[model samples]
Target: MIVAVASGKGGTGKTTVSANLARVFDAEVQLLDCDVEEPNAHLFLKGAGIEEEEICIPVPEVDEVLCDGCGECGAFCRFHAIVSFGAKPLVFPDMCHGCGGCAKVCPRKAIRETGHRIGVVGKIRADRVTLIQGRLDVGAPMAPPLIRAVKARMRKEVPAILDAPPGTSCPVIATIGGADFVLLVTEPTPFGLNDLGIAVDMVRDLRIPFGVAVNRVGAGDDRVHAYCRDQGIPILLEIPEDRAIAESYSRGELIVDSLPRYRPLFEELARGLFDGGSPSGNRAGYRPFKSCQGRFRRRENGCALELHGKTCCGLDNRCGKPPCEDKR
Candidate 1:
């Protein structure tokens, strides 16, 4: 099972939850930090170096020898990465998506693909977990390609947790794609609530099972709590605002490591996600409501049903289409 931990904005404890959750799991788990642009989970996990590899993408390469000044390649380019002028095409490697449309449409066959280095994917070994993190090259505008490379290393049978980048953009989408569930972390402030709605919308559109985790719970007003209640989004686990927790974070320590008392809380959250019910019997949030028609078992002991009409039919992950709705 793949569970993705994400947030609508930065500094909301998204990676904090992801790294610690993986820490709670057994050695079969893999902790993937897909925040390629600003991957900092490695600092928290502190794994021993295992392996590193350079990941590259294909960009347009011009073979001037086979060229004629055909505007076809330029015209077919959607990103405007290539524009032909006077027997040559200006190539902007950064803007290219590497669709290879220009090369296919080129009548002169002057354009082909060449390797472009965008980032590196590194593997690290913690005590019982393998940490995989992707780092984009400095000033690299695109991250989806490298994010894809990082996700490609997941093992199908083992449980994998992805610590996605903040926000609900292409990078986040790329990171959370094909996940069994997503745990969105947000604060209780106005800004947090605003972006939380956007992130919730994106996950619902993707048809993935998701829930919300409010960090720094008491620091802000009850509006975020009220919002979750009104939306029927379950409150998985709450981390109260504590000075020691803040100090531990500053020193790059895991919350569970610093405060072993909270290990049960993280374990409950993970169990709730995988067991088809809310953690600790709080089933008010997004339920895993598996469709009886899908691969999931139908027995009440094995399957959890939802109050809504949601069903999973092996279409997407849940029902081949979006199952959750945002009435709020």
Candidate 2:
């Protein structure tokens, strides 16, 4: 099972929860930190030397010498990465989507595909968890590619937890794509509620199962609980605001180690997601509610049952059609 721990805004203890949960479960787990632009999970899991691999993206490189100054390449590019205006074509590598259409349409074959290093993916093992983190090259505008590379390291049979980048954007979507469930970690502040609403909409649109974890539970008002109750979304777990927990976190100690009692809480979280119900029950097999019929599910055939009326597998599952809303 793949569970992605994410927040609409940063610093809500998403990484803390992810790391501790992996430790408490003690299963063959993989922790993928998909926050490519700013990866800090490695700091929490120290002494794990990350094996690095370069991440590159294809970019169009135009050979002016072979060009007949044809505008076919320019006209074919919808992103306008390549433009021909009476002279040698100008190529904007950053704007390119690497579709290869420009090269395909070029009569002289002047355009050739080349790779540009965008980031690096590192695999590190600590205890029972394998932590994969991606670091984007400085000034690189793209993050989805690196996030994809980080996720590619995940072993499907093992329980994997992805530390997603904060905010509802392409990077976040990429990170949470194949997750069986998403745990949105939030504080009880007004900003938290506002951003949580946006994150709820994003996950709802993707038709993924989700639950909420209220961190620093007593720091603010009860509005978050009120919203969750109103929306019928489950409040999975609550982490109280404690100075000791804060001090331990500051000292790079795992929550399960600092507060041994809370180890069961993290383990319960894993069970709740995998069992598809509240952790306080008889531990029976989980059954999805009728209302959640359209949510994504992994089939026995190793394919994903997308709500878009199609079964998909591999990376192609990413492009499955959007969910069709039920008018009822």
Candidate 3:
């Protein structure tokens, strides 16, 4: 089973949950830090025998010799990676998505695809877990491709945990693709509640099973709890806002290793995830109601606007489709 730990926003302890869960998982597992832009899981789960591999994506290159810029390739490219005004097409490799559509649309077959180095994927064996992480090259135009390379290294036979990048965007979607389950980690703050709803909607759209894990449980209000309860989403595990936990994290130490008391919480999280239900008797294994589908809009109070039957929200519409209504 591949379990993904993700958040809708950054600094919500998503990686913290992922690292600790891998530490206490009873079975052999592989942890893929799919947050290629800023992978920090290695800081906590350190090991030797680190191996690295180059990752690349295909970009279009126009051949000057076979010249015929009918502008078909340029017109076909929605990203405008190729542009032509009845002249030789200008190829912007950095802007290309590597779909190869530009080459296919070239009337004169003048366009060819070339490998463009984008990032590096590294693997290391740490104790019981194998860590595979992708690091995107600086100035790289994209991250989904690099994230895909990291996921490609996942051993299908072993249970895998993916630490997805924060937010419901292209990179996060790429990382969580094909995951058996997703664990949405969040704090108890209003911001957490808002983003959690967005993340919840994302996983629901993908039709993947998911539950909530509230970190910093003691700091924020009960709105997060109310949100979960109202949505019927299971609360798998709750970690209190503790200074010792923060200190351990600052020192790059695993919570399970430095603080034994918190080990059981993560162990329970693992159990609930793999078992398909909350072992603590809280509601689990419930699919989010599709009818409750809503787009996230930032309110002054940081509450998520669940617009039933509405397809879009102004700023948070990462689906790339036209908004049904611009409720900003």
TM-scores, one per candidate: 0.83, 0.81, 0.83
Query: Model 2, clash count?
Result: 0
What ordering of candidates by TM-score runs from best to worst?
A: 3, 1, 2
Weakest 10 consecutive residues of candidate 2 by summed lDDT? 281-290
Better structure of 2 and 3 per TM-score: 3
Estimate the lDDT of model 1: 0.75
lDDT of 1 by residue, 1-328 (tens): 6788999978999988988887776445788999999999888888689889998888888888887877888888888989987678889888887788988998878888998889899999888678899999997787999999999987665677899999999999998988878888998899999999999899999988777877776677667667766665655656666687789999999988998766665765665554422222222222443332322322222111122222211112233434324211
**After superposition, candidate 1 runs with Cα above 4 Å error:** 275-328
Judging by lDDT against the true structure, name the best candidate.
Answer: 3
Off by over 4 Å in 2: 75-80, 275-328
| lDDT agreement with native, every candidate | 0.75, 0.74, 0.76
**What is the TM-score (0 to 1) of candidate 1?**
0.83
Taking the tens digit of each residue's C-alpha lDDT, what string does model 2 give over 173-260? 9999878788899988999999999999999999888878878766776778678766877666667777878998999998888788
Over 38-59, each residue of candidate 3 has an lDDT whose tens digit, in order, gives: 9999999999847999998899
| Candidate 3 CA-lDDT value | 0.76
Model 1 weakest 10-residue run by lDDT: 299-308
